[model samples]
Target: MSRVILVFYGSYRQDRQGIKLARWIVEALAARGDRAELVDAKAVDLPMLDRRHSDYREGEAPAAMAALADRIAAADGFVFVAGEYNGGLQPGLKNLVDHYLPQFAWRPAAVASYSAGPFAGIRAATAWRTTLGAMGMVVTSTPLSLARIGGAFDTAGLPAGEDGGRLIKAFPRFADDLCWWIDAAKAQRAAERPPF
Candidate 1:
């Protein structure tokens, strides 16, 4: 079976909660026959968009951004693990999404957000939905939010609370949805190709 590539859209720094969540998810997806890869926004060298060449059709996106677009184009699905910033979406994630709009169309997307607040980063998830929806991606409803993320991860690099169990349970459903959509889209694309 071909594996679905999961994209972790967050900072790569070791101490970051979003990164931790991304790691856990990638591990879980790997266990489920999916080839997961984290698109660490921090490590990616995406320069600010130069106004003159930002459009996909006519503009030259930065090398890093172009590489990211290529990755998205190849992936079967996407899992966005994001961190909330002042009750909104993270700028780094926004930049990454902004740079790769054309390539993300019709892809299946799942979002995970982490924060130390009560809302559990749902606000960030909503913002992410709007952004991904604008790009024509199908957003999954099996969303996961890690509240008080600092206390959730153990010394062994695993989620140590109920949140971890919740994430584990949610993933299979998300994976199911992703596979369904991906296969359907692939079939549709294949049918649309004219035989020569």
Candidate 2:
């Protein structure tokens, strides 16, 4: 069955490389016949979290965030694209994720992280796994990490040379695992009461 997957990228600057990578992943998913949608955190333009308990209890999310909440709620799975900054995820991405808690419950999440350095944003992926788990998401274990991102992709945003070869080979497995989780999670959600 076709799955609705949200490809969420955490980048606010126009020159950011993560955005390009996010687009590539979305295209790849679409090519595989999945219904993929891109959610650029910068475009969402959510403010920092500073809401009162009454506001949260009343479901009074900021106007800009309401639509995002709806999209996240509708998605069967998620792909989180992030870049490492100060050994963690970008603040904008973190803030956007913090805006909604229940929407992520019991969903599956996969992480793809890129960096200019040799580590390939592994630290950021690790951080995402932790945070996503805490939010009640079943994060995939096989995360996609691209190091020296400047040299990783060509003009078409496809991986180049050896990097391309490796990613091309690995992507199918990753996608398969993620889709399995999505199907299993959706079935579980349908059969049982929500944990939240």
Candidate 3:
């Protein structure tokens, strides 16, 4: 079955490169017949998590947080596009993850990390793998890492030349692995009906 995937990016700058990559990935997934939507961290406008469980018990969460949680809960899988900051995951993305907990359970996630430098944001992807895994997400092992991302795309925001070819080649395996896990997880969730 076709999957509904959320391609979420963590970049809050006025001129963000991660957005471009996020759009590209979303389009690619769509072309492959997946229903993919791009979710910008800035657009979500989630505040830092400061409320206690008692606060949550009192009433509904903030509108933005509730909407984000709804989208995440509805998605069959995820593609988290992370940009490196100081050789680590961006704080905005970390905050987004921290704000919602149960939305990610029993879901599969694939990470695509990018950097303006030569390192390809591998460290950020590594950190995300650990964090998402701990949150009960089945994170795919084959992550897409883009190095010198500033030049990796063309004016149309599509990957260019070698980078484009490489990503196109690798995407099938990544998507396959992610979809496999998503399907398996969904089946298990249906059969076991474990509370997430």
Which regions of candidate 3 fall more than 4 Å away from where they truly are?
52-55, 193-196
RMSD each, Å: 3.4, 2.0, 2.0
User: Quick one: ranking by lDDT, best first?
Assistant: 2, 3, 1
Q: Which candidate is the best by TM-score?
A: 3
Q: Which of 2 and 3 is the better model by TM-score? A: 3
- Tell me the TM-score of each prediction against the true structure: 0.86, 0.92, 0.93
Off by over 4 Å in 1: 12-14, 51-61, 193-196
The TM-score of predicted model 2 comes to: 0.92
Query: Which tens-of-lDDT digit does each residue in 27-75 have in candidate 3?
Result: 9889888899988878886777696222575347777777777888899
List model 2 lDDT by residue over 13-117, tens digit each.
767987877888899899999999999888887778875222564466566677787888999999999899989988888887887888888999999888888
Residue pairs with backbone atoms closer than 3 Å in model 3 (clashes): none
| Candidate 3 C-alpha error for residue 121, in Å | 0.7
The model with the greatest lDDT is 2
